[model samples]
Target: MAEKCANVNDSDCSPAKKVKLNDEDAIENTDERNTSENDATPETELNLSNFKVTKVLQNNCVRKSICIKGTFEDREGLAVVLLEQKSFPHDESILEKGFFDEKTLFRKHFTNDIYRNYDCFPTEEYNSIQTTVIYPATQNHIEKYKRHELYMIDETYELYQQVTLPYIESKSLSLEWITNILEHKAEQESIIYEDSDKDTGFVLITDFKWDKQLDTLKLLALPFQKIKSLRELNASHLPLLRNIRDAGTTAISKKFNIPASQLRIYFHYQPSYYYLHVHFCYLMFEAPGIYVAKAHLLSTVISNLELMSDYYTKAVLSYVVFKDSPLYEKFKSRGALETSTCETLDCK
Candidate 1:
């Protein structure tokens, strides 16, 4: 199994120094936290009320595989990637079966590699070797990520290099950072909406004539998680969405808290490119009576689809946007979606 690392606030500490905390120590720490919460003092809350700790200590955090090493020809199709830690809120219960809480511990390494980062830890199959690390549950910065793509660990390093496969450890952004970043982006550019005009409801419904032959395209909402290109979207008779300055799922979810049902998603095809436009009502989750509406743009699926003569397939990628949320802040920085380019309020 791979080696585990400790979680510590290292801003003031030296780089090479390492702190060791065994499983017993970790369990004791958890117990201590539980005990403190049980007899919580009001003054302790006051001490942390103003001072927010951005850095999380790595302990029982989850690791995600962002990039996989090796090609289909190398490992017969098995991809290799790295793992990084994730921190959750202390109050949230760590359940046995759920998303993001199942994985714990390291397994065996692939033939030539030293460490293996599996999707889930402690499974009977891959019990060779693995590494697990956790972080303190307070850090919530989104844009501070290390991996943009799975193979592209270093922002400065290109991912075109070939490497041995079998065992893999991905180098991606911490799950804490990814979650916060996505949440932050959603909060910022998501369109705000209001239900004040339920009497004068939407009228543009019957215009969309569904064509059976055009392919039943179920366009998924935006902020494409691991998808890097349009080909990966796997939509038929449609195109991928890109240039997500004001369009993305994260942006919409953060802004309104309403599902994608709140927006009008459409497809447009140009001679050279395809477009997806998401029209939404800009209503703040906090201010339900007030209504806000906006339209966001998405770019072509493939930058150079004209060059492909063989003609593989097509798909549509839908983007949803909301206003003023945590996701808004994160996307504003990543250039995924922004509020500055939105049209003026027409509901006035």
Candidate 2:
């Protein structure tokens, strides 16, 4: 949830004050392991039964996360309740507890406990949440949590070399980690699949966001080639693309037992980082940045390259640019997307 910043000096909005509030509200209790019934030892359940949901801010079933904008029946104003099922630790012993189990859930602090959610896994905890509820949630809170305006401007082959390319180069970002991974200096143990073919080679590693879970699985395939994002891919890169599409799929099937049918393999245009990488996640995962406006399917990319050697080089690509994105300022400076629709998806 966004920090409701009215004025930085506002006592209620101060980080110090929030920390103090969380400290006071922290629920001190032993791990209430596997309680199949209603609670007896109560500091209140932080129940949402009375929350009158006026709107759903975001709902991603793949990630088991939901955000709702609403007000409690007993409350006077709006509120935002974000509840997401906590991730499991990678520890095999704790991961044995599946969705079939009888288990109890605990929210460490009545207000802030997202960090403590992981502690419950070892206690046979099948589900828990690091949730946040912003009550009397003013329009300010709603605006902060509200989805931003996304303009899908079409970038042609000319626009790439002229406007977008210059804009991208102007921004300085770090990729030392990418180098470390490719050189085998980092994340050595986490690499589940690897190919050292030099040109078409890549190491498939587990993404931090996914702690080895099946449903919300996330894996990244980083190629040894120095090719930056999808923009750099052309006919000559078909081998690398096909390797990622075919070999990565086979490796995932062998390692995770997830069939090719159940996976979403794609590349992000205007990727979070400029480095080239392929993302693989459970089809149901709905991981961030998977919207059509950003994600280009690996299969589709392969076909595009197969059909036209310079498909990406000469293609007109439509992609979203968030207002807060680093690329946003660049686009604004160049008047790059000046004519695109600037519609806002407000919570109201």
Candidate 3:
């Protein structure tokens, strides 16, 4: 059984403990073996020597691999390695089960500390280390939104059209932003992919905030249509998801040289802008707004629409709002929300 840390927020936990695995077992299980003194084969030792350890996690029995190291390889781009103690149990290893095997373990043990800064393993040799992007959602929060707040989404849609849509139309804002990107005024270096079409095309640009480290590829999908957020999504809008996923995945794969399975494509509710756009990020990069309260996987959205043509029309969606958000104010005014703090609202 995995042991729980007393306080995950604490910085001074005990150093990762070392245990002894049988030498024969270590040699036989090369794929699951750790890059430690006890388990490192000649080839593994040579390859890992090039990297330098940069971070360590202590007093975390559940975390066998606490040290993370990185170095730029001559041909392999950036190579990152997680150093694990040889004595840890192979059966209990999160990597052996799958990246998202246990939601609580993934969130509490894997996401909190040193792992946040390290890149997902650079090569198959380091596959024993797994990471995930989705945050764990509390059952209470999900149930509360489902029961009381989902209906407000419909009201929020009307508010968006009345207030936000006019501002966007008057300024011709998103179009101008796209023009700036094409003209090289913004995000020139970050343009990983572009599908130019005057009719139904879109551009994929790197988000300005992404640092490009740790597989944090934050690409924005700006569609040609001025559709405003998921509220505008319906059967007709479903095709946009396919086009963006197909094109975005291909481009990102070419750029990163990774399979499409390593990527996560989704959209956020109450996007910063009113324009309809999508987000393309690595599955291991925990970019903001990825919680269940706000993020909706594009694939799920498409399937929902396929099952019900007017899915968005009748479906109750849950979204989060900050205390000062105008949308939150709208819900509060209508007596749909009791508080202005960051809370989830359900809209139908």
In terms of TM-score, which candidate is strongest? 2
**lDDT ranking from best to worst?**
2, 3, 1
- Show pairs that collide, candidate 2: none
lDDT of 3 by residue, 225-332 (tens): 667668668888766677777777776666566567887788776555456778877787766567676788888989998998877766666665544344555566
State the lDDT of candidate 1 residue by residue for 1-348, as single tens digits.
233333111111122211111111111111001222223476433221223223332222223222123222221222222233222223334323222444555344454566554554633332332222222222121211112111101111111111101001222223332232224331111112211122211111001111111111111222323332332233331232322322233333443244444433422211001112222222221111112121122322233343442222332223222233233333444544434333335543
Candidate 1 Cα RMSD after full superposition onto the native fold (Å): 25.9
Q: Give the TM-scores of the predictions, in the order they appear.
A: 0.19, 0.60, 0.49
Q: What lDDT is reached at residue 227 by model 2?
A: 79
RMSD to the true structure for each prediction, in A, is 25.9, 16.2, 18.1
Which candidate comes out best when scored by lDDT? 2
> What Cα-based lDDT does every candidate model obtain?
0.25, 0.65, 0.50
Better of 2 and 3 by lDDT: 2
Over 213-319, each residue of candidate 2 has an lDDT whose tens digit, in order, gives 57778888888898767888888899888877877888778767889999999888876566788898899876677877788999999889889887888889988
The total of clashing pairs for model 3 equals 6
Q: lDDT winner between 1 and 3, please give it.
A: 3
TM-score between candidate 1 and the true structure: 0.19
